[model samples]
Target chain A: MAQRTPLFEQHQAAGARIVDFAGWEMPVRYGSQIDEHHAVRRDAGMFDVSHMTVVDLAGDRVREYLQYLLANDVGRLRTAGKALYTCMLNEDGGVIDDLIVYFLDDTHYRVVVNAATRDKDLAWIGEHAKVFGVGVTERDDLAMIAVQGPQARERAVGCLPPAIADAARDLKPFSAAAHGEVFVGRTGYTGEDGFEIILPGDDAPALWQALSAAGVTPCGLGARDTLRLEAGLNLYGQDMDESTSPLESGLGWTIAWEPVDRDFIGRQALEQQKADGAPYRFTGLLLEGRGVLRAHQTVITVDGEEGEITSGTFSPTLERSIALARVPVGTGERCEVEIRGRRLPVRCVRPPFVRNGEIKINLD
Target chain B: MSDIPGDLRYTKSHEWVRQDDDDRVTVGITDHAQGALGELVYVELPEVGMELSAGDACAVVESVKAASDVYAPLEGVVVEVNDALADRPELVNEQPYDDGWIMRLEQVDEDELAGLLDADTYLETLEDE
Candidate 1:
């Protein structure tokens, strides 16, 4: 049987189309997915992201343990509530999982990882933490809600407790703060201003009801996927997996090469790859024809080289099909994608294709 | 409740058919089909004059969530395709019965039309699913 989030009843009440995702029964859409997509781009929308795994690490050596476990250095998170995005890598430089770590204090930090990767991520973190005597506590009792859009912050603040609302209103992007039992972060997957709120699981349904009563649209994973794809964000399993490295996944920027003496996992393999220069190019593609772009489609360059689309979708914001493809290094501005046995022309562009509810790429 | 016009014929696949006075037939997916598929972003119609057998995959309708093939309900030669849907595929979602008609077949076999389910039978099929 699949697991149910705290907001599952609310989702059913709103007529959401529930589907099995990563062994959990989750809403794929409420009504029209495109309408939900537009809701996040033009106004406020909320998603029940309670299935994400939240783990708290505590000990005097928690910070040090994270620095060694993750590719991105957590040392830069100087202020409490400051968050850093990073990839947990295996010793072979392959991605284990991508996660966000929030610095709460010198001895305590909170990490949120993808739900599908929960078991492995927890086991990996637990094994490494043992040497440093850090405690890893999975907080399944918590539920997360991500409210996003241009008007997201304003509407979301109205649904929170007064004191937390005031504190959350002042939060900068990528920052989080706690009030009582609720933790509010000014961060989101959609390329819009928003807040991700984590609170006790039992209180989630009431909060969802309040947000809906406040006129924030209840969106689902379908809209979330489209919004994230338009923003050029990577989905863990589709974009990169245990066999893929950050250097070739467009996530090299997250790696911290400083503090040369730090011997993190996969450091040696990454250093060797960097010295040799990464071979594959990670980039975005805009379909120039009528057909919808989809993952696993073969991409053929004008010069006869080949690649594949890792994630593709019909971008509602841009009114065009866009994709993220991994191609041969030095792949140029133009390529052709094979859709249904016909080669369609495509333009290579630096992602994201849309941001802050605005189209970033030139259609013409 | 889904709208199922009693006068029209439907396929188990969710397409509705209307026989015209000229012996030709017009076809489009039902309202329930469009609602299930969500907002369409692209529609790939078959070329006019193309030959099709009953149940042939004649066209495709794509939404943000997925792509589905629209099968021909009866054997015929395509006489006209909905060109308007090339630029505005949402017609299938907004006006599936009228403006959203996918194709008009000129040479449909009269015997094949008899095999399609009536509105009541089609509604029963939907319930079974």
Candidate 2:
């Protein structure tokens, strides 16, 4: 049996096809996934992302603790409500999880981690937190919904309290605000303009229905996966995990190297890898031939060095297959992906295939 | 419940076969199969002249989520492949039994078709799953 969200019955009412994802029974789609994917790109779409874990850190040493725990320095979040995306890495430099931490204040901050990595992430945070005596509280009493796309903010705000709605409307990108019992973050994984709202768990069903009534299409995890892939956002376990380092996984920019003495975890190993020349270069692959590109497919460069695709999918926005792969450094513009024993040609390029309702990379 | 045509025959792998004539049979995935796979993005159909043995994995169906193999139910020579799926693969999701027909196989043994499950038996198998 799998765990369910507060809006599970609402999902069933909307005719969703449920699937087991990360030990939770979640809606994969309400109808056609491709249509739902397009809805998010073209207009407003909402997703029940309540399964993601939210942890609040409170203590005078919270900032110092986070500076030691994460690859990206939370010290950059100078203003309240500002959010930073970062990686939690193991001592040897392998990525434990990629998450967003919102700075509410010096002593109170909130962090959201992936659902699949919830258990380990909490354990790791708990273990490291004891040294700082930071209070780590899981926010299971809340539920989250992400309304995304061009008209997402306006529609989502209409469903919130007037004060919270006004605060949400004034939010900048990567910012969060709390009014009364509601917390709204102007952050999302879909590479679109949106708001991720966290409210009381009991209010989820009513909010879901309200969003639907406001013409926000109810999207599911299927569309979420494709949208994030098109946005070049990495999926936690698929794109990177405990075995891969941030440098090789296209997450080097998230590491803050300035104030070099901060001595964050995995800093030494990452610095050493940087000094030694990273072995693999993470890049995007566009299939020039027919057939879908999928994870675990081998990519062979022109010079014969091989790499593996971390995440691959048919981009509904581009109408072609795209993937993120880590190939040997110096691998050139072209490579071949082995799909079912057939080597199909592909072009190597920068990621972010689409962003802000526009194509970021040249399809031609 | 998925629509299972009584006149058609089904393989345990979720393919449905309809006898177009004495030796030629039209094949497509069952409605249950397409529903499970979700909206398809691409289909790799066998060439019209390709020869296939029973249970041979000849075609491939690629959905947005993943790719699945489409196997041959009996020995036959491919007579026709659904060309429309090359451009519009969602036909398999929208109309799996009609326009979504995957291929036509000629020279199949009519006697072997009896070994395949009928609509009722196929529904029972689906329930067991």
Candidate 3:
């Protein structure tokens, strides 16, 4: 049996197609997935992301512990409610998981991690915190909802209480605010302005109804995947895993190498890789032909060197197929993708095919 | 509930078949098939004059989530393919029976059409699944 989120009943009422995802029964789509994808790009749409694991760290040494545990520098998050996106790496420089850490205060911090990696992430954090005397508490009692789009903030404010709404209105991107039991963060996976709200599980259904009434479409994981892919965001367990390092996963910018003394877990291995030229290159691919791009497809360069697609999908915003590929360090502007035994030409571009409800890439 | 036309024959794989007066047979995915697959973004059809056997995978329909293979209902030679679907694959989702017909088959086995399930039988097959 799979676990159900607090919003499962609401999903059923809205005629969603439920599927098992990472041991949880989750909604994949309500009706037309393309329509749901467009909803987030053009207007407000909400997704129940309650399945993600939320853990709170508390202690006098919380910041120090996180600095040693994560690859990115959490010390940069100076203000309260400021959030930082970072990757937790194993000692061998392999990515354990990618997460967002929120600095609530000196003694309190929150981290949200992927659902599939919950067990390992919690165990790893617990083992490391023992030396720092920090307390790790998993917040299973909470539910999360992300409302995203160009009009997302305006419509989402209509459903929140007055104080949180007011604070949320002025919240900067990558910042969060709390009111009573609800926590609102101006962050999202889709490349648009939005809020991610975390509240008590019991209060989820009513809030979902209110948001739906405010004309925020109830989207599902299908739309979420497409939207994030179009935004050039990475999905854990697909694009990277414990076998891959951040240096080759298009996440090198997240690593903090300054303050030579900051001995994060993967520092030695990462420094060694950086000293040598990184062997792999991560880039984006735009299909120049009619077929749809899919993961694991072989990409052959003009020199006959090979690469593979890490993530691929049909971009609802662009109405064309696109992908992210890991190729040799010098793979150039043009390559051919083998789809159905035919080699079709593809153009390489910097990612983020669409953003803020507009096409960011030149199709021509 | 899906729309299963009473006049057509259906395969267990969810394709509908119709026999024309010229002894040719037209085939397309059923309404239930299109609804389950969601909005199709691309369709790959076998070319005209291609030979197919009963139960052969003749076409491919790709939705945003995944791709599904459309099986041939009866053995025949492809006489014509729906060229409009190359640009507008959503036609299969909007009208799976009429404008969405994927291909017309010539040299079809008439006995094979009789073996397919009727509307009532096809609905029962769906219910069992």
RMSD of each: 1.7, 1.1, 1.3
Candidate 2 recovers what fraction of true contacts?
Answer: 0.93
* Top model number, DockQ: 2
- Expressed as tens digits, the lDDT of each residue in A1-364 for candidate 2 is 7999999999999899999999999999999899999999999999999999999999999999999999999999999999999999999999999999999988999999999999999999999999999999999999999999999998988998888888899999999999866899999989999999998899989999999999999999999999999899898899999889989999988999988999899999999999999989899999997789999999999989999999999999999999999999989998999999889999998988999989998777
Q: Which residues of candidate 1, in runs, are more than 4 Å off?
A: B21-23
- Across B17-109, the per-residue lDDT of candidate 2 in tens digits comes to 999999999999999999999989999999889999989998999999999999998889999999999998999988999999999999999
Looking at model 1 chain A, report the run of 10 residues with the lowest lDDT sum. Answer: A156-165
Write model 3 residue lDDT over A18-124, tens digit each, in one string.
98999999999998898899899889999999999999999999999999999999899999999999999998899999999999999999999999999999999
Clashing pairs in 3: none
Model 1 scores a TM of 0.96
Per-residue alpha-carbon lDDT of candidate 1 for residues A227-312, written as tens digits (9 for 90 to 100): 99999899999898888899998999999999898888999999999999988979999999888989999999888999999999
Q: What is residue B4's positional error in candidate 3, in angstroms?
A: 0.9
Candidate 1 Cα lDDT to native: 0.92
What class would a CAPRI assessor give candidate 2's docking?
Answer: high
TM-score of each predicted structure versus truth: 0.96, 0.98, 0.97
